[model samples]
Target: MNSSRGVLELPPVVGRFVDGVGTFLADDVDEGRPIRCRFLWSAITPTSCRWEQAFSTYGGRGWETNWVMEFTRTGRDCTNNG
Candidate 1:
């Protein structure tokens, strides 16, 4: 994943992308109930990527979830190859 400074480790295959992306989710179930979550990426490289995904469901559901994922290169190589 990308660091706080936005420096990506960038593996040999995917050394073309930068990290430092994040997502957020929030909701309210009842009159006084609120749910919220924040996610961050831990490592990122040109050939691979990793990040944390989290969510919180409050009030009615009272649910919380967290996850991580790794991605491999899936795109066809172009002439540029850079």
Candidate 2:
């Protein structure tokens, strides 16, 4: 990871770092395996944000994806209350 400040910045709501765990087909062919992913938020606003993720398998090559999403605030919490 780079130590230089201001290299990446994000809003408080977007979080500085995010992590995800899942399984995906290797090369879109093989059986799914556990994958760990990390995301860094580079830009964020009240209604939109942009980030990128790096994914790595337990014993395989890594991949990445960039994402941008627009959000609308519903008066609901971000958790499963049911």
Candidate 3:
């Protein structure tokens, strides 16, 4: 886990980090193991360090970052035989 200042380095989980204009789109599709995340903070930006980066770059507080939806796949939906 690598970190600088208040930047948190969470263990990599199965997911996609899509690069947007300002914000990043995180699609957590790994149902078997959801993206478990933890974080550190900075004195200047106390609320959420990464939040600002994600919000500012992706367009800032608006209708876009309203809500995050997660989809679940059932037995048959998962074709992989493990």
Candidate 4:
């Protein structure tokens, strides 16, 4: 599996709160293939956010939704760093 981490920067849309996307790659060790995973997310509040992720094999099939996650920001520093 790929162990490296990557960052994606997306320009803010006119009315959106999301700043970017995050991507992670992993190998399907059992199938001896590589898989691509992506996160599409946005901050909903100073203390919370929502996101969805998808996965697919390279050049194989279309992406499938793996999960949707929503969580509260744990700390007080929920400032925009971008």
- Which of the numbered candidates is closest to the native, going by highest lDDT? 4
How do the residues 1-82 of candidate 2 rate in per-residue lDDT, one tens digit apiece?
2246646532122233435322223222123555545454544556545555555564335565545344455657769773
Please list the residue runs of candidate 2 whose C-alpha ends up more than 4 Å from where it truly belongs after superposition: 1-30, 58-62, 66-82
**Where is model 1 more than 4 Å wrong at Cα?**
1-32, 56-65, 75-82
Sequence-dependent TM-score of model 1: 0.38
Q: Which candidate comes out best when scored by TM-score?
A: 4
Residue 45 deviation, candidate 1, in Å? 0.7
- Give the poorly placed runs of model 3, Cα more than 4 Å off: 1-64, 78-82
Q: Is candidate 2 or candidate 4 better by lDDT?
A: 4
Report lDDT per candidate: 0.49, 0.44, 0.31, 0.56
- lDDT tens digits, residues 60-81, model 1? 2443446877877767676778
Clash totals for all candidate models: 8, 0, 4, 0
> If scored against the real structure, what TM-score would every candidate get?
0.38, 0.29, 0.18, 0.43
lDDT ranking from best candidate downward: 4, 1, 2, 3
Evaluate model 3: give its TM-score.
0.18
lDDT by residue for model 4 over 1-82, one digit each (tens)?
2335555533222223335444443334225556555556665677777787666775436788879999896775547753
